[model samples]
Target: MADKVRVAVLISGRGSNLLALAEHKRRDPDRPYEIVLVASNVPEARGVVLAKRLGLRTWSLSHKGMERRLFDQKLDTVLREHDVELIALAGYMRLLSPEFVERWEGRILNIHPSLLPLHKGLDTHRRALLAGDEYAGCSVHVVTADLDSGPVIAQTRVRILPRDDADSLAARVLEAEHELYPAALERYAHELRGAIGEGREGGSDD
Candidate 1:
């Protein structure tokens, strides 16, 4: 496991995707990453509870009164303490400050519950239904300062059914997210490790 990338998953609610990723790691010994930490702003977040149940190291602090960067700084401290190499934003509701994004640029990934570039912000399933779109899906992408506007790594599309409401569509899309995220994260970790290796090996000796 020395070669595995240390990953930290950030969440603000029930951690369905967190469970999915953890299960994938548990079942796949060859995964190129390991879950090192699970942290949240809400002290009672169900995700934090689930992480503890899964025997993962966990941290939580209420973000109610703290400034965005201040809260993120504390969170960053915990992540650094765990030597986190990659961050997966799984239903993490807070908008990260530009400073935080810069600190982990190209190292954060998020799974947005829309095809993305289609539904950028919240209420995506409802918006997709309202827009009369033919499909709704989830996307795994790089986390940029812009909300849900990062470069997509992979996506899974669910057909928008005629009888679907927001809740129905959301339920199906969430299922897609569970399947899409773990696979995308594993792929991204491998590619990132390879890219770093290439950069190091190809560096000029000055």
Candidate 2:
């Protein structure tokens, strides 16, 4: 049997999406990806504690006052040390440096609260409501240097009720994210495996 794809999840807040992914792995023992590390830029992130409870290794490094590239370098070192093959960003608030994005490229994924190409940055729910959009949703995409601009792997939409406020709409999108992200990760993991197989086959002739 092939080894499971080693994954590292990065979080900055509640890590609800991280928990969703973990649950998915638990429910499906044959999942192609295994989360080996849960890392955060904030020491107080609740996800760290939950990850520890789940018997996964956890790491924290404060991004405060550090240059973006410098912080990302440290993060890169940590991920490499753990032999992480893929990275998932769940509510990880900070933007990664271009260097980091380039290094990971196709192996990094992020879940954004909006449909993407619509509301790219923060306050997505409020922006969608203010724009009078009929529907709001979440998107799981490959991470890129261009913020939320990446090839979307999966999405789940929710109707925006007329009475919905930022909080209510955000809650709806959060639910969608929890559902969509895990499915996206699973799909991507399969794709990654195929790509790796192709790479190895191509290298055999060398």
Candidate 3:
């Protein structure tokens, strides 16, 4: 469909969230997004294999020795080649350069393990547990130059049980992430479509 938002997903691991998004798209034929590509920095990343099995286009570019900006430029080129209109970072571990973040800006989204503004970096669940926090959750936010400091679009919170450890808490939060991410992506897709429509109408003044 001409109006469908073309999407690309970047992954560095198992791509659990990618699977969730793909399944959501499959279950809802009328969803506003079409997953056009899946790319990974690690050539042997399981996500690449999964994407291939799902019959989606997949690209693998090694970032082992390349500079961050150079690698991200390659990624940008691949996304553009696929005509991607939106990007979703699903379990992608690499920190993107400021230039890359600025290039995509509002068009890129990332799902972080913690409620965000709380645990900005890694080991979120363990950090929460160690701090004796009462709640833990996942957040979907627009990707910015700052790490996990972008504007939050959606979040799903889960109670921290008295008997919970990092692993258990992480498992529950991951489930929450799986649900929250797809919903957030759908919301963002609609917003993107509206913005494009507005821009087109504004340009019609010519």
Distance from true position, residue 191, model 1, in Å?
Answer: 0.9
For candidate 3, give the lDDT. 0.92
Candidate 1 — which residues are off by over 4 angstroms? 198-206
Q: Write the per-residue lDDT of candidate 2 for residues 1-206, one digit (tens) a residue.
A: 34678999999987899999999999999989999999999999998888888898999999999999999999999999999999999989999999999999899999999987889999999999989999999999998889899998888889999899999999888888888998899989888877776776677544
Cα lDDT of model 1 by residue, 72-168, tens digit: 8988889999999899999999999999999999999999999989989999999999999999999999998888888999999999999999999
- Give the number of the best model, judged by lDDT: 1
Give TM per candidate. Answer: 0.95, 0.96, 0.97
Instruction: Return the candidate ranking by TM-score, descending.
Output: 3, 2, 1
Q: Rank the candidate models, highest lDDT first.
A: 1, 3, 2
Q: Is candidate 1 or candidate 2 better by TM-score?
A: 2
- How displaced is residue 85 in candidate 1, in Å? 0.7
Worst 10 residues of 2 by lDDT: 197-206
- All candidates' lDDT scores? 0.93, 0.91, 0.92
